[model samples]
Target: MSKNYVLSLYNKMGKLPFGKKLFSLFASNKAPYFKTVSPLITKVVPSECHCLIKKRRKVENHIGTVHVIAIANGLEMAMGFMAEASIPTHLRWIPKGMDLQYTAKAGSDIRCVALLENNQWQVGDLPVEVTAYDENDVVVVKGIIHLWVSEKPKK
Candidate 1:
């Protein structure tokens, strides 16, 4: 079978120098709201996605820390990519809800990871676990992004 579209793109683009940046840019363009965090997608594969968001003024709150909303944006972006890479060809998914907690101060650049188990790829309210860590590897944020999965409509 042909590779999933998103994974195929990543496999090809992920080989070139600065390809990850380009791919992340392309993705952000497709979903404009995700641009708020300026996420750099580092890895994309079945069941998991990794992303990095630098702690810049644009993403920082008045307290000079990465904003909660910015971290949420990164988490959502990672989850979206992971879902795209993991879902079965006959199925599709959309975000239904998100529940997140700010566990610690994000004092540095953040790494966001979104993960789903193989069996969790079925239809229903699939909750993809997501976590954001600071430079020191402290869990700065953690949550679930709920997705509604269903068979794709007939063409």
Candidate 2:
């Protein structure tokens, strides 16, 4: 999909609590690969964010291991949600870059636990690293998310 199209969807999503649910349904219906590795934001608080993904055959690569792209997409999903949740209602956030390291093979379900050092998700221009782990608790990917912050109208 085009970046403009995706950003338009995201902007619309920022308006509703159940937006991700509806978006996921639409995405998974049209692109069933999403059904396998789509990450869902389960909970968010001031200090932490939780995301979950299911392992399924559809996301497996040629060797029956999880595709690297799929894992990255899941990581981005979690990071995006946490990035959105961490900032106040008066700010807009966009990812600038990502530094990733794949430490282990992903052969099972995955969960991304994004811990914020403070409630601050934005402080001008800076990058944050969010780590993801597999079901066995092994580090699978570390994403150093670079984000640009701007002010948005208060909700």
What C-alpha lDDT do the candidate models reach, one value each? Answer: 0.93, 0.66
lDDT of 1 by residue, 1-155 (tens): 56799999998999999999999999999899998888899999899999999999999999999999999999999999998888888888999999999999999999999999773677878999999999999999999999999999899
lDDT tens digits, residues 40-112, model 2? 6555545465566767787788887777777766666655656654566566787788788888888887777
Q: Which residue runs does candidate 2 get wrong by more than 4 Å?
A: 1-36, 153-155
| Residue 67 lDDT, candidate 2, scale 0-100 | 74
Best by lDDT: 1
Q: Per-prediction TM-score, please?
A: 0.96, 0.70
Give the total clashing residue pairs for model 2: 0
Q: Which residue runs does candidate 1 get wrong by more than 4 Å?
A: none
User: CA lDDT of 88 in candidate 2?
Assistant: 66
Instruction: Give lDDT for model 2.
Output: 0.66
lDDT of 2 at 60: 82
Model 2 residue 73 CA deviation in Å: 1.1
